[model samples]
Target: MNRHVTTGFLPGSALAGADLALPGVVPLERRRLQCYLALLFSDMAALFSGFAAAGWLYLGPDGLAQGSHLAQLLLPIFLTVALYNGTYSLHSLEHALSGAIRAQIALGLAASAVLFIAFYTKSSASFSRVLFSGGIILSSLMLAILRAQMRSFVRWRCGGRIIHEIVICDGGVPIVLPGARVIDAAAHAITPALDDPVSLHRIGVLLRGVDRVTISCHPSRQRAWATILKGANIDGEVVDDAVARLGAQGARIVSGHGLLRVSVGPLGLRARALKRAFDLIFASCALIALAPLLLAVALAIRIEDRGPVLFVQRRVGRGNRFFDMIKFRSMTQSLSDPHGHRSTLQGDPRVTRVGNWIRRTSIDELPQLVNVLKGEMSIVGPRPHALGSQAGNKLFWEVDERYLIRHALKPGLTGLAQVRGLRGTTLHEDDLVQRLGADLEYLDGWSIWRDLAIIAATARVLVHPRAY
Candidate 1:
């Protein structure tokens, strides 16, 4: 059965007749729901398997005692998967499968280590080490295989078999079908390049002709295509090969990487409001919970340098408002370069010893909790841009006007951009553009659960620094 599911990412109006749409082109609503459900189910199954395996291994007659350290360790490992599994969905299954498997293995090893420590400390009775190790190996393999299988199933079920009728507006460039069919095609007076100004007038005409539209172009042309399509009334889909646009929505089979840029517009007002309420409540609680840690970090910073404990700098907030964002001082006070620096170059000398550690560990950002409590920021959203950062100029000014829509919500402590390693500074104009695109994406798809997931993932990354 074709099920119509709504998501925080797509408007309900976009869902009309979406099931009949073509491959590489479904209403954003359906895609978001499908992706979220797939991730949710996979995580549920993995958690269940982990717990089941642990119980069978440690609680059975031939197993280790339930009260043993092995059992305690295994329980936490299982809990870890249950708590953190949602973060894995941030990446496409193909790219993250190996890493997910490795993480499962690491969880097993951590559990084993905890058990060993317990034994060494005489906190538990002796257990069959061989059996325990065997259990770990068996459970790890089983979870990995199950996760892989789940990913495969999701891919198969969501693959394109459905076809959508799309109106194509080609301004005279030889339109290549690449095998896909266009229900109706037209040539406009102005042939708009992907990077060129989108012909909203042309798009409105096309939307009236078909339920959806697909714009195919070279990779370099993608940004422009996206910009133009964003203004169109109809939902837009992208295809690596222009021909694939003719296939059924949710049925076209393509590599995951090709689907990365596919996105829809903002969620409904209700979802946005719900997300804001959630951010306020959660950010408040987080600030309260982390208050002690913040105090300790403040003391450390003060002792390390005779500078301000809290660094307040002008940052672009929601709706292009300028706010003095608060953070633990992680750099020695220095004036910005006269050239109007846009990004922090690698190994910036402005970083002090304590600053380096704090930045790496993300402890320097603890003071942002005050910002959160003050309702100037969120626990999760797009990270606020520095006052003169390239992203502010390129995205807020040069890109599509819709890009500024992201500022409608409060700035976030961590966001989809940061988790995707779009943090730090944009070295290139393209990078800033892409970062803003992601920010706009997050704003369009804001949700309570999504925010929670981002925050959790941020915690994980903070524990293991990669970008810094």
Candidate 2:
């Protein structure tokens, strides 16, 4: 199956006499190692040159080498910090700003450390204050400007491929990776046979210059591929659709069996603490600020039909458990659909006059602040759905098996999907599809900053046209 779907500057080789001819991919590890060394040397030169230049300008020709001592003292510290901060790492090669910011941080930390040492050691008087200040300013500016141009430098040095990565398809889902070479295992006789020396040799040759290899294959073949990858001594990944379907965070072999970690909580302890604190604080503040409006809406709903002011309906929440979600009563008491089997439609006869206005402005959902305060819901997450909710004729879970994965986190009053106007009714399967996609994306990456942004975006859609 060895076809070069993505040429990536490597010319595909023609088969010769039953032998697999893999395209020549220059080993990338050496190139990346060389790039790292180049950055280190360039940084050293920048620091030394900046100091020497500053010394000349500030202290005349007599002090051309005056700041050389400081440069020498700071070089190791800066390089060590830069390595840890990823200034000379692969991510730095991709984005110039990432590397520049890291470089600046490294330089700042190094300078601070040197000055702190000098101060405590009573050696501050030895170095001229003006020379030290001028050196730091010049070196920092040079580093930032130099790093800004390193993207092109790395591109030139590494040629077209920054990482020699390849994706080998072995009878599984086909995937496209931007800069990776694609190979077909069947076309190349690349079988996962441990006993077949010829096939093992073929695999080795194909992976010779590669840094990382990803195989997309059926579950039956995954074990074989995993065995081969482990012996190959390269970074490897086996694509399993089950991992995504099960929301598995990672996998590990324990007690002579593999375990897929699907039960892990979305947020870590620290993240949970931060999110809970944020939910409580925001919900509390919002409740107080909107009290007058909440009271007015309640009064309106109560007076409209002389019915109960609040509607409590059973809906799915975090951990796939049932919770009574509260909202302003929006339908005639006798006509209210508690199980949500029937989605409300525009001009639905059951909706009262007050229900129309409150639902339109999302005033009806304000009562969920109590849910947030009770820790049953988050300020932002996938919105809770009633058990009987349907997308078209199919129940939501029946329409898509991944629907329940949304319950891994607490349901929210506002969510990534809702803010994007994917709220209101799930009229079609496609509607749920769009919302589920957004919900899964939110689950993949949760951050307080993103939550804040979603909340801010929610304000714009409070009175969306889709509201019934």
Which one wins on TM-score?
Answer: 2
Model 2: residues >4 Å from true position, as ranges?
A: 1-249
| lDDT values for all models | 0.54, 0.76
1-468: candidate 2 lDDT, tens digit per residue: 111112221112211112454567877666776777777777888899888878889989866768787788889999889878888877777666887888889999999999999999999998888998899999988887776666677888788767787879999877766687899988877787543323544576677677667777778876566545544535566676466643444675423334343333456434666899999999999999999999888888777789899998766566444567999999999999876778899899999999998889998899999999998899999998865677887777666656655766889989999888897788789999999999989988689999999999998999999978
lDDT of candidate model 2 versus the reference = 0.76
Clashing pairs counted in every model: 18, 5
Off by over 4 Å in 1: 1-269, 335-342, 391-396, 399-402, 463-467
Q: What's the true lDDT of residue 92 in model 2?
A: 78
10 residues in a row with least lDDT, candidate 1: 1-10
lDDT (tens digit, per residue) of candidate 1 on 391-453:
444533344445544655677888888887776666556776777788878866456778778
- Candidate 2: Cα lDDT at 375: 88
Q: Give all candidate RMSDs, comma-separated.
A: 16.1, 18.4
Task: Give the Å error, residue 17, model 2.
Answer: 67
The TM-score obtained by model 2 is: 0.51
Q: Write down the TM-score of every candidate.
A: 0.42, 0.51
